[model samples]
Target: MKKYSYQKCTAIVLAFIMFFSLFAGVNQAKAEAGLNVNADGAILVDGETGKVLYEKNADSPLGIASMTKMMSEYLLLDAVKHGKVKWNQEYSVSELVYKISQPTSLSNVPLRRDGKYNVRELYEAMAIYSANGATIALAEVIAGSETNFVKMMNEKAKKLGLKNTKFVNSTGLNNKDYHGEQPQGTGADEENVMSPRDVATLAFHLINEYPDVLKTASTPMKVFREGTTDRIVMKNWNWMLPSLVYGYKGMDGLKTGTTDFAGYCFTGTATRDGKRFITVVQNAKDSSGKNDGYKARFGETKKMLDYAFSNYTKEELVAKHYQVKGHKTIPVIKGKEDKVKIYTKSAINMVIPNNEKDNYKPVLVLDKKKVNKNGEVTAPIKKGEKLGYLTIEPKNGDKVSFLTEEGQKKVQVDIIAVQDVEKANWFVLMMRSIGNFFGDVGHGISSTVKGWF
Candidate 1:
């Protein structure tokens, strides 16, 4: 009987352990399947604030294919803005451009050998159809040569704070595709490369700086040089557009890229109900790795968008005029008031996960340069004077990041003085100084007496 009882107890314990193991395995599987974006690198961010919503290996540099045109588009728009280039400016194709445009296998709108195309038409072809010849043509016109334009691209990348970006050519094609006519400084087999994070940063600046580019990017199709013999119908490769096969609602202007080296890549943006999101998927493939193509890249982007819209919403975590505890007021020296009240200059709103609302907390950071040893500001404080900063952090210690490296730190708002504080009158200052001197002497005398006792 005793042996049987012991055996039964052992069996019960084994069954309990087995049940928990199965339960844990099921939960782990669910977590892994949450957002299974099959790609070499991917990222999603809020278009307005550049806050990173999700990321997967987003810092690794990889082939970007035709997305390199985004940088070209930026420079072109900047030139037009600054009066350096004009839409009606004409470009005469060089011998190298003519040869590159003649390849039937490449994505090109065949150019007439003796024809002159204006900036507007070539821009449409490059932005809408990813035409390599048109891109190189613009690069030449803007910088006098493709080689010089590449230098400008890298220079602008640094200016925009793109950390992991490099431009080998304006067209984002492999140098080998140039057929020995590659840009002067690039290698024969080099391809333009950028990390997903850098790509998203570039897109963020592009959309914010030149929103009109979306007008061309969102077009479903257009005829090159309409009403002319050389005309060809150029359809946009971004299938996620509302007029395309996938026809994702709120989907619009962005870029798509594909090559044997880059596999498939896309930088997509969409707006819905006053909210916009930007997503990038690099070298996208399926779990089986057999469906690495145009569809795969779009599919992965949809997954990220769906997850973002479903789980996150904009919340005003801190209200304007908010005063941090233990930092509500700052001492004022030689002023009419002994201290001045301080509050946040503006409210801080962030798109955060629904379940993590209570996890955030406020942190105050005072500017040491403006304050004295006692944390006091001198007289003559102006209303709304910025004195410090208020930054937000998650109490749960969750990692929060942004699309740009500079935004990696937490979001912050300015802390300013609530009202003006002028210098005290001379009579008041004299009386205060006399009182302080006497108080110090009395304290010293008291200390000496205590020591003698």
Candidate 2:
């Protein structure tokens, strides 16, 4: 019996060790599933609400390579939107544009001084191929000079509330030696500087203002000035899009940047199931000159995209017409009905982490100071009228309160009245008045008797 007991005890110990080993492995995988980016700065955000899902050195200012064209792209698109320029309008390439286009090492579509291309073709070349010469030509056409265009780019950046962004040239190339027309705020360094956060901000604004740019950004390859057989083929630099090994399910266009000083950078965006996300990876490696380091930005971006789509979920936090807990009905003053039901104006959907799904708390607060200061809604309340706002916050120790890409907390939704309350009839009013008069008289008598005593 003693021998048998010893063997059973040993077997139970082995089973316990095996169970813990599997549990540890799963936990480690879960923790390591997230992105460990090898970049100077990075950020991932919800494209719709601009909420930050992940960040690392997001605010640190660094050299942004070809990403500066996003601002140029924005101004050009805005000009087109405002009827300043048409897609078919042709712009002449200037001598300055030709000189910048001479860099054989950099990306360019080779715009000659006498070359004339339409706005649509130039924009596509700049956005997809990161053609510096095409961007310069577009800038000059819009603002008459690249220097003036840089000024406009800075102005737009300021208007977007970008604190750590500055533009020296339309192209993101290092221009310290080039002594052409310089913008007002440009330093001698001559390369645009922007944090990853600011880059994401610019990307968001670009997509929001001009969604058509995505069509250009996502194109794998297209002929420049497509009617001639000798036209150059411009292929997109962003590898996260479709037809690439690292391509995600819903991966789409944004931009990519690389330089000896700036390192490898990429701002990637994707959409899945009607939800979209944007990621910015900046200064991904010091040896961006090498092939392995140049591809680090895409690898890091893929990791971030994968983690966000896999670990988080968008769920309906509050459904429409759903009665709020704690306060069931609000009192109606001088109404036939005693009270009315209140609910959210629309359904509240929130993107929460998989582990934190049940940890969030929705706190509902009525705007007593605005509509119902005295804690009562007057009669003749209309249905669907905005009563007050419902602020939903995470419970204590919950990590749902993430910072937004715009550097602010998420704003909660507002709740409204679900039904109307009609005014009370004359008979009911009269009966209530009579009851109040008798009650006042009785109170007066009781006070007088107490005074006598």
Candidate 3:
């Protein structure tokens, strides 16, 4: 009874101490994102792993403002790649673009009456300056109209596996132009809106599919000729481009957008020593008396980047010519052998933040039975193909465990097919000389008869 009493007293005291410490640990500055981050629907994701490094309100659907221009650029760029539009192609700004810009939406690049701009100029302007008019022009140049272009945007979003996103306009002005979460919701706006995850996925894909998009977006300054007038200097809205912090400034490009609902949002990225990434922040105070909104953004990003640099490291989780996570061997149909050791498609690596204990080892996981091997995917299997998974946490029954970073595609593991000599040795001689004698006679008789005829 005395031991139980003592134990209960100790537990009560410890609970009190923990409860107090919890509130004590709350940093007044870091706890609240503040006007610098009004209501962040943000994400700091590893560009390579598609893993969430940090998140705030990441799942909630919020206004995206001019960020929707990313989607417009995505489709327009697709059009250009597919020969639907030309960089030098000109599109006369339509009346609707002018009418749409009249709202209190983001409009750094308003169009003039009968004004014209090339597809490249519009893309540059929209990507760098979050120009509403330029985005509309680019979309029109590709889809011939905003409505049709928006449909394409939604379709593309669906294809990209963006489940919690929808597009209602070329430019991302959410209040009126973008609809709500559903197509037939009670109310929808004219712009586009999505979570941080979808945005990151879009950004990841853009960087992977069209790396040149980064080259254009990172333009600190561009002299663009528009509408037969003096060359307009399009300065980059992404403030990170001007300076590099800890060798990561080269990743200085992408998009930025702000509105009353969306607040201030910026997707900033940089690369150092081969590592590259993007940092996104949403719902922070804009330039409206907020000094330079860039400071808070860059500050947070620098911290994340610095942590990624000082602590985390990209190491090979799986190696080429090495066995996959679980499977001992892979069935090789029509190959030289009945089966071969299935190795990781590429050298799998991960950017693990430092401070993790040295004893950390990724646990191997394989359920090859579930994967549809699509007829022996040879060397150079595509990036997202199922290449066995690893467990980040060692198994402990039903306690739960995280999966390892997805396998990467780096080393070429082209499959080598070897002929089965056993199968070849059993060749039937076609009833001995039947082919030799009969084939020769058939050919000779046909030729001789043709000559006689």
Candidate 4:
């Protein structure tokens, strides 16, 4: 009996080891499923257009984590752009900044006792490292306090049309919102939340409108106090920094974030060939709470970019509403010249939504006479001027309108009547008494001569 008991106990122990081994492997695999590493939501979109190429739970409001800093960066850049702040200006870190840097929050720029730094250095530190303390310091530097800065953030959000996003704090640090401050705790007291679509839209404007902001965001590393012994150097947190695939050529830089409630989130832009694309992934489960599901984000972003480049194309759109190839000159009366030029004014282009070269047609909307009733074109129609319009319409009925593709200076059209040409009219000649009298005299003389002969 004792020998049988020992055999059974050994068999149970082996089974237990095998079970955990498989379980650990499964957990690790889930964390690396690049597609399944799991986010409450994810999205891939065209940076040029808001068209969603791939979306999973796109509209759901989830913790954006430090992707919130993008907004702060935008507002800060706005201050610089609008002449509210200068790039070279110096600002001393206040005590508030020192207090916020105690934790490992992102944007923890090492500002010492009344640490004085240039606005440029602070910006680099905050953007490159996602330094939470640096963010707070910069906010104070710009707005005098983090509270005022958060107010500015909300205003900027509304202007960007970010309806679903809320900004309660500047650094996106843990604070309580119930007492009118950023919240911290479980999911209940969270500070910021945004949809995948809003995040991409904001990024689109940043990449397209303000390339410099993207320029700064794409920095791989920043070296402060370069030659000094205590020089601080920070590396970009985005892992896609080095190992980019064929579809991921322009894997530049962006922001990454994590917290107890927010999990891991990333907002990045990559260029393949010549096309630029943006991807946002949020609330991804850390398979073992480790390297994050970067695998899923990379795979999906590449797929999205590939789908965009392969299936979509940039089609030259030409407005074809009212266009005149060879506008004719019309004679004028009592004008600078004898005639004026009358042409059509409209543009034509193809709205290529996909890779297919679809057929197109333009609807011409012009005056019957190709000129205004008063015989004028632009403000100063010399002799002949083009004042016609061509409305472009797709055969299927969907349409877009644009100004006529025409030269800035309009050709003059004839403003006065050509009375000499009017005399050539059959009615005018028939009504001439002098010509009738001469014709009668010639007829009488011919009758007399013929009768005498």
Judging by TM-score against the true structure, name the best candidate.
Answer: 1
Model 3 lDDT tens row, 1-453? 999999999999999999888776765555343323333666766666555566677777766777777788778778889998888997786776766544434555666657766777777778877777677767777777766777888899888877779776777765355323222332454446788777777777777678788888877777766464545666777776755332245566677777666666777677777676666766654345352455655555556566556555666644655553455554543333444444444454556555443434445444455334553322322333454544333133322211112313321232222222122122333433466788899999999999997
- Give lDDT: candidate 1, residue 329: 97
Q: Please, what is the whole-model Cα lDDT of each candidate in the order they appear? A: 0.90, 0.80, 0.61, 0.61
Between which residue pairs do clashes occur in model 1?
none
C-alpha RMSD by candidate, in order: 3.8, 5.4, 14.0, 18.6
Runs of candidate 1 exceeding 4 Å displacement: 1-33, 405-410, 447-453
Measured by TM-score, how close is model 4 to the native structure? 0.63
lDDT of 1: 0.90
Model 1 lDDT per residue over 86-170, tens place = 9999999888778888786888998888989999999999999999999999999999999999999999999988888889999
| lDDT of candidate 2 at residue 411, scale 0 to 100 | 42
Q: Model 4, range 1-453, lDDT digits (tens) per residue?
A: 999999999999999999999999999897444343256777766555444556777777778777888887888887898998998888876665666655543346566755677788778877888877778777877788777887788788778777677777765555542233332222436567788877776776666657787677767777865786548777766666644232245777577766656667888787664556678878764445343455655554555555556665655434322323543444443333445544333233332447444554533344556445655432223222333444333567643321111211111121221122211344544655567798899999999999998
**Which lDDT value does model 2 have at 78?**
92
Report backbone clashes per prediction.
0, 0, 18, 53
The global Cα lDDT (0 to 1) of model 4 is: 0.61
Off by over 4 Å in 4: 1-38, 49-51, 105-107, 176-188, 242-247, 285-292, 317-354, 359-453
Q: In model 2, what lDDT does residue 201 have?
A: 89
Of the pair 3 and 4, which is ahead by TM-score? 3
